[model samples]
Target: MEDDMLTCNSVESPGPPFLDNAASSVATSLRRCANDKLPVSDNRDTTVSRWRKHCPTPIENDNIFEIETHCKDPELCSTLACDIYKHLREAEAKKRPSPDFLETTQKDIDTSMRAVLIDWLVEVSISRKKVTEEYRLVPETLYLTVSYIDRYLSSKEINRDKLQLLGIACLLIAAKYEEICPPQVEELCYITDNTYIKDEVLRMEASILGCLMFEMTAPTEKCFLRRFLHAAQLCHEGPALHLEFLASYITELSLLEYSLLCHVPSLIAASSIFLANFILKPTKNPWNTTLSYHTQYKPSTLRDCVKVLHRLFRVGLGSNLPAIREKYSQHKYKFVAKKYCRPSIPADFFQDASS
Candidate 1:
């Protein structure tokens, strides 16, 4: 099967690599900031069927790894996990922000300004800044906040002056939904240097909720990434945890690229997993039958998205927006932001074994 995407020259690097990726050590397989490349495991030669898929594989093969064994953990919602996630998948469309809002609706702002707002939001959530203590919003809250900003912008037009205010209101609303102890509205107001009064923030919050029809439970890339990572982890023991962090790093990088709005959350999650696997284990095929079954996407389906994300990875390494790169480079996150891979993915990797 010929991949027509390669001939299109979509993945070709226009200039320098973009995304900021690095990792902390968990023994020898993981690398520190100095090691630009992730060292392949000593067991790289071992053939694990779960990590590498084969055709005509028995039906029980995929289930055993993701369900039969993983669901045994007491913390997991084992009995209802499948049904719960099934519903989330069904609900993604309703929550998806307008993919082309910048072109169709907004007259005052463009992609760069939206990118700037997201960068600021990242700082508001996790960075150490003006406040005596960091605000520390959850990752889901940030994703939801961005969704709210985009969804609200999809229908309404506002000038650049109010963009930051809209971001503040969205973050407050998202923190309320996803955080156990949400931030005080006044504290959020403080984060903005009191640019908008308390009442103004509250009014924007009301506007956002009303515009969204009060539906706050929309699914995000992070929501589906957890499930896809479970399937991707299967039997890969040494790199499992690092894989999660690295994949997440890739997904977050995509948030800065407004063009990615067109792709659905599930596709973004699956593509991030694919890219992370290649970065960590370049010698082996990244996508297996298990991933295909779980994500309901073929390697071919993820071709364009993976390439676009890789472009972000290459460009974001030295991007002006340093919040995501700086945060992920910490020791706790395994320093995934600094982990480097080959400049370009091989065109053939997108093809299945059967192809």
Candidate 2:
């Protein structure tokens, strides 16, 4: 019995202290996001600004309590859900920031490295599309990968050779966090056409985990959408299903531009839900009396998380970059591509890679 108790305690205990540095780093990122309105906005210059006008701004409502109460009836919520549709329409209006803009200003990557990274990014974009289409991966998965990669590269000097490996690792980590049951190591290896061995992938996974401090509970874009969808009472069998697809689309665009990260997930989710509602139910009375009655908050008065995400989507659409179409292409990867890849980090980012 004593041995059993000891074993249980050991099993439940948090692992080694290598996570301390990672935890501090992530904490710093989160703090920066909180402090600055434009925290992640740096990488998205020239290519992102055009979409600013295209994103929809939800109508300001004085009474959030009314919106909340009206949401109790799922049917009314579905029809009145104005956030998602507005977001999509807005997203359609703007253009994505060019890949060149990111390549130009990033401290870690020079011109040569940027060009090389773009090639790998093309592969990443394509791989993500295939995986999402085939496995029904959530848009959040791709978003998480972009977030991870962006954060990692912010301070690292990753070599062009290992870019794809970094992308793969990011995707794998995201799948484990967002998917119901992630594909096994061998399965992922197979998917990559044996470009990476199972063990190599595993090592990359460990490296990623170590970097993020294994603290994974940051609210995803989906989490926010679900909250407001439920609060607005729009989640029904038919509407809920369609709304999910729209949410995925909205989240996918946010990945290319990091500025959206500055905003709260709740705001983004709310905007997407409302916009989707509007798109699906166009003729429904825009004047939802229940909105003012149930909602305790004001849409326009609060921080503009939804508006930012919507803008990013619009920017990508305007850029007319082949990423959207190219992302869906199903091409096999080459083995040499994986073996020569290096991390996209600067030397000073981490004192110890193993940790």
Top candidate, metric lDDT? 1
Candidate 1 lDDT trough over 10 residues, lowest sum: 19-28
- Each model's lDDT comes to 0.80, 0.49
What is the per-residue lDDT of model 1 for residues 150-187, given as tens digits with 9 covering 90 to 100? 88999889999999999999998898899898888788
Please give, for residues 1-355, the per-residue lDDT of candidate 2 as tens digits: 9999878877886665355878978988988888796544444323233333343334343433323334445554433344543453344223122233344435444533433433344444344333445444655665566656655555345665556667777777887888897656676666567788878888877776776667444445554455455545533334454545554455544544445544444445555554444444534422142332222224442335444543544344343344532442223211111121121212222121122
Deviation from native of the Cα of residue 337 in model 2, angstroms = 33
> Per-prediction RMSD in angstroms?
23.6, 21.5
Best by TM-score: 1
Off by over 4 Å in 1: 1-64, 128-131
TM-score for all predictions? 0.80, 0.47
After TM-score superposition, what is the CA distance of residue 196 in candidate 2 from its true location, in Å?
3.3
